[model samples]
Target: MKRYLFCEYKKTRRKYIFVMAVAITAVALCWGLYGKYNESALKSGWMMMLYQLPLLNTIFMPLLSIVVASRFAGIETSMMKQLCSVMPKQRLYDAKLIYSLSIILLSLLIQFVSVYIAGRCFGFSGRFPIELYALYFMFTIVPAVEIYVFQFSVSMLFKNQAVPFFIGAIGEFIGLFALFLPQYPWIRNSVIWGHYGALQFVGGDWDKVTRISTFYLMDINWVMFAVSILLCVAFYFIGRTLFVRKEV
Candidate 1:
């Protein structure tokens, strides 16, 4: 397993996968932090950050996963026939899956640290809200896992990376719009891409006249969270089976 994982990294070491992941995270963070630090924003900066991040994550995380998965899948598809002759198909698939997930996990960690630094640097109000941040991390990572699994699966099955990328782009469009349907939570819950918005524990209510936003803790959708995990497991097994059974 270690050798295979290392081999997977070696295959893409020149591709600057980590660099791309970091760049995406940075862009999302910058976008979320944009806007004037007004009175209301200053008062509830931590919560504001939390509230706004999922909206950005809904679009950016899947995009990162799509690019990473497609790059890895492209690498595998080109060399799969030769690699299969000397290696077990399942191991190859597992190696790539594990490596790809590790990349995502690292990106998530970077995002967390970047947010924390931004909070400290900007002097956000209230305590650090470690518990809330923890919940945010869980909410973000779960949906991301599901998205990555589906993205990776499609990327692997179709040598044309465009198929999975187009699917991911469509999902992003739907998920971003689904955020406006908060009154109909089920609408967001219906799609894996929208789960980022669906599972968010922070919400913001803005007063149009005052031009101020109030951020508060919202109920976490535990049921949808659980469902996402189950779906991720299903996707993983289904993807692995297909890859293992495919004619190299």
Candidate 2:
């Protein structure tokens, strides 16, 4: 199993590094360049970047997931349908899920580093709160795995990649933007991850009867973490079910 995954890692590793580097470079340049307007612009850029970090998941994860899953699927697509059906069903299903998830974890490690670099460049005022960044990595990784497993299962559902890729793209776009609609607070709490990102730091600055009307919300911290875990479990089985029943 280790050998098989390592081989897949070798084949697909470039995409992870390339995508993460691009995201980090783009984020840094956007903030670094926009910082020239004024000191406030720089500060706002920093704050904005912090709030928008979760947006990275939506922007990069989907296409990355689709590309990785497609690569795995492409390899297995050549096998005869009967060959898969007659094999040890558990091992066959496990191989696909394991390969897809291993790549997802690798991509996530890159994202964690990239986001940390972006945070530092934005200029941390304090010790950079290792715990906060750790949670950021944890929360972000849950969704990354969800997107990867979901896309992998979707790819297996159809031989064609276009439809699954499109669906993943559309789903990610909606999930990223849900924070903007403050009126629909349920969406803000339940579906939107940026909500956690905001409360994580932005809470400190929420001025009462002043410029920033928002404040720290500690109410849903446990719930958000729980939901992320739930998503991981939910998608694992979902992908497993799809793969187990899928035709070769």
Candidate 3:
């Protein structure tokens, strides 16, 4: 498993997926910083940073997952068929899942570091919300796992990367619209792409002029989190079954 994981990492790194994910995350962080600077009356820049991270992740990370998963699976479909033939199909599927997850973790790490730096730069004051940070991390992972599984499945099942890539792009656009449908939380929560916004049940309110935090919560949408995990697990098993049956 280690050897297979290492091999996938090398191939994925060669594809520049890691670089692209980091670059995209950096851009998102920069955008959040820009927003913070322009809104002077905002209370708790740290809270804003935390709130925006999941939104950015929702918009960009799924697409990143699709691209990375496609490139990772492309190896087998393109020229590695013979090499794959020598291995059990389930092992290959598991390796690909792990590789996709590693990319997700890398992206999350970049986001976390960037947010911490940006919060400090913005002069956020008061106790660091360690509990909130842990909850944010958990919330971020739920959607990420679902997106990775859904996109990775499509990428592996179909040899053509364009199919999954387009699907991911479309899903991202739809996710933006999902935010406005707050009246129907279930509608948004049901889709993998919308899980980011769904997880943000707790949020912050700030004064328009003072920008000082007026209200915030260390709470979350537990139901959405649980549903997302269940869906991710289901997707993983279904994808694994399909992948094992797929012709190399």
Candidate 4:
């Protein structure tokens, strides 16, 4: 497994995955820095940056995951019957799942580093909340995995990348719109693409007239989180089954 993973990583080094990861990281960092500058006066610089991380993840990660999954599956899809005849299709499917997930994890790490640097540079005055950071990290990763599994299934099920890519593009727009209609929290939480906004670490009440905001640790939507986990498990088995039985 290690050898296979290593070879897969090497293959990705020659692909656009690394370049896309870097570009996403750079854009996210710039946006966070800009948010830090604008919200610094509100005395929630750290929270502002942290909040923005999830929002960025919500909006972009689906598209990114789709691309990674498509590329990873492309290896097998391109070869089709020849590759399946030699290796167990299940093994190949699982490896591609892991490969795509590793890319997602790399993207998450970049977002974390960007948030940490922004916090330090903006002089967020307090004992750093490592606990909050850890929780937020888990929150973001769980939904990301859920998204990856679904996208991976779609990518593998379809030989043409355009199909999955188009669906992902539409999902991206849906997620962006979901962020605005917070009154219907379930509306967003129910969709995998909107999970980042659903499982937020920090939330607040804002007075429109006074332009004042008070922040608090947002309650974990345990039900939604559990549903996401269930979806991941379901999709994994379903994808594996479909791929194994697929006529190459």
Error of 3 at 188 (Å): 1.0
RMSD of each: 1.1, 4.6, 2.4, 2.1
The runs of at least 3 residues in candidate 1 whose Cα sits more than 4 Å from the true structure, single-residue gaps closed, are: none
Local distance difference test scores for all models: 0.88, 0.59, 0.77, 0.79
Rank all candidate structures by their lDDT, best first, as comma-separated numbers: 1, 4, 3, 2
Which pairs in model 3 have colliding backbones? 41-209, 41-210, 41-211, 42-211, 42-212, 43-211, 43-212, 43-213
**How many clashes in each candidate?**
0, 0, 8, 0
Root-mean-square deviation of candidate 3: 2.4
Q: Compute the lDDT of residue 91 as modeled in candidate 3.
A: 88
Residue by residue across 1-248, what tens digits does model 4's lDDT show? 66667757876777887678668767766755674244534477566556667777876788678778888878765577887787778877887788778878988888887778767877776766788888888888899999899899989999898999998888877777898898988768768888888888687677898776667777788887788899899999998998888888
All candidates: TM-score: 0.97, 0.72, 0.89, 0.91
Candidate 4: worst 10 consecutive residues by lDDT?
35-44
- Higher-lDDT candidate of 1 and 3: 1
Q: Per-residue lDDT of 31-132 in model 3, one digit per residue for the tens?
A: 666752545424456676676666777777877787778877787775657766688888888987897788778888777777777677667776677777
As a TM-score, model 1 comes out at 0.97
Off by over 4 Å in 3: 36-42, 204-213
Over the full model, what C-alpha lDDT does candidate 1 score relative to the true structure? 0.88
Q: Candidate 3: lDDT over CA atoms?
A: 0.77
lDDT of 2: 0.59
Q: Model 2 misses residue 58 by how many Å?
A: 2.4
